[model samples]
Target: MRKQLTVITALVISFASVHAQDATIEKIREQGLTQSKVMEYAFRLTDANDSRLTNSPGYFRAANWAKNELTKLGLVNAALEPWGDFGKGWDLKKSYIAMTTPYYRPLIGFPKTWTKGTGGLKNAEIIVIKAADSAALEAYKGKLKGKIIMLHRTDTLKPTYKPDAERWSDEDLSKMAAAKMDTSRRRGGPSRNVVGSMPITTRIRKLAEAEGAIAQLS
Candidate 1:
């Protein structure tokens, strides 16, 4: 009889505790739904700043703006704290690329980051090369001087009918929660040269530079 009474009392307390938590969560949900500045805050962070790479001028500007905004909201100790030094900062000023020969067309591409700028607008013939391996590179060894080389072919893109964004369903969440780590499969082994040294991607870039290729389309 005592054990039964103890179990009943414990279940009653548990039910009360659950009800209290649910009430608190509902209150929070109501408050969030009615009064939320999430969109405004998001816009201020993202739209206000063009780009915010760590230690860059844009990053510092965004940080300062955030600090000022937080201070306005009566937040204490809102200041930019110095983290350890990141590498040298760079900013993109003006970048443009285009195809002139065989009917003029504007090329849609961004300049490679942290690279030296082209002196001015350069007009060069685009040469497509297939140099997948060391032996393949030899064919274009004497070639590619002062010419823009294309390393890869253009891929055909298909339009998707599905919506770009959607909220996760309960079933989706359950599946994600129950998902197990996949550890069975192993990646393919590295390609080894005759000297047993792994041929790195840098070697190809170096070879292209040695051949006097102006710029490579990655």
Candidate 2:
């Protein structure tokens, strides 16, 4: 039993190592364009589709669209892998955001992919909560049980304002390397708004019984 377990563990680790080596992530990183491709894909997917609907005929259209693009890019065996059963479906056809009051302005955001639609209701009041500490958090206990929680930390927005490119001298580069890089990127700050979907059972499919809100805006 011990020898068999050791063999199994070795095989598992070997398979993991191979998987890591063959990852598309590693190839993209090697090309030094992970950030650029992300933006390009984001624009192509979200902006091109205007997707913020559910069972969106557009969503399935976009899926087929992606399948075509993936095959074009030489991803062998690229195809839609459908999961067993979602008796009904949903998808986004369009999304719009603006501050209608307190001065009209555009709210900068991209909807979380596959989020449910606004169901013909074009506008809704946005409830913002600062989920910071015990007291501030408690202030929102029952209230925020269903409201959108917008965390106010700008940790992930790094100081990306490099005005000009230059080759630093060895001494300058060495000194820069001595200082630690920023750690803010390690903080997983954004919340996944997973409550857009209405729940399902064999007999009934009810609206999202959110722990309290219609949707999480963030």
Candidate 3:
């Protein structure tokens, strides 16, 4: 009698598990096929502000919009809690940069954040520099005065036939899961064994300013 009771209990548990799995699958199908509102919410959030930097006015507007949206969805206590003060905000009114001399081309570039803008349309010569360190920078000491500096070599672009977006196949996912992590020490730690000086990106920017370069392009 006890053995029969144990078998019966096992059967009941298995049945309950199957029922729960079916319910979960049904919920996923309902949400994926019919009841999802992802795009609607995304459009509302993005359209509320042009730019949403943390300290900008547009950010506050977007925050309020999100709070209101949550409140409309019957969420309780939707509020923007104030964190500590961030730095000052900035708005870009008008920006235009183009290559006029040697070839008339519309240059694609974005100004660095928190930097002063070029006063209206001003033209300057492009000075290409391939300096990787302070020692290499000595060659262009007086040459960068009143010029736009190109600090890095341009990469060649190639056309591809593949689609822009794709879902990972089962094989691709399995390969990613099986990939090994690199446990080796990085080269630039605080130890004496590390080779090479500090990074040249910031140092190059400072050198450009000191040398009177109008702008530095990466």
Best by lDDT: 3
Candidate 1 regions exceeding 4 Å error are 1-27, 154-200, 210-212
Can you rank all candidates by lDDT, best first? 3, 1, 2
lDDT of 3 by residue, 4-69 (tens): 999999999999999999999999999978988888767766774767877777778788989998
Global lDDT of each model? 0.79, 0.60, 0.80
In the predicted model 3, the residue pairs found to clash are none
Error of 2 at 212 (Å): 3.9
Per-residue lDDT of 1-218 in model 1, one digit per residue for the tens? 99999999999999999999999999999979988888987877777886787767778878898999999989999988878877898778887887776778887888776666667777788887765667776787777788887775446789999899999999999999999998898876655653342353466577768877778777
Per-model RMSD to reference? 5.4, 14.7, 4.8
User: Candidate 2, residue 209: CA error in Å?
Assistant: 6.1
Global CA lDDT computed for model 2: 0.60
Q: Considering only N, C-alpha and C atoms within 3 Å, which residue pairs clash in candidate 1?
A: none
Q: Which stretches of candidate 3 lie over 4 Å from their true place?
A: 1-32, 154-163, 173-198
Lowest lDDT sum, 10 consecutive residues, model 1, at 192-201
How many Å off is the CA of 47 in candidate 2?
A: 11
Q: What is the TM-score of each candidate against the true structure?
A: 0.69, 0.37, 0.69
Off by over 4 Å in 2: 1-90, 122-125, 133-136, 144-149, 154-159, 163-211
Instruction: Write down the lDDT that model 1 would get.
Output: 0.79
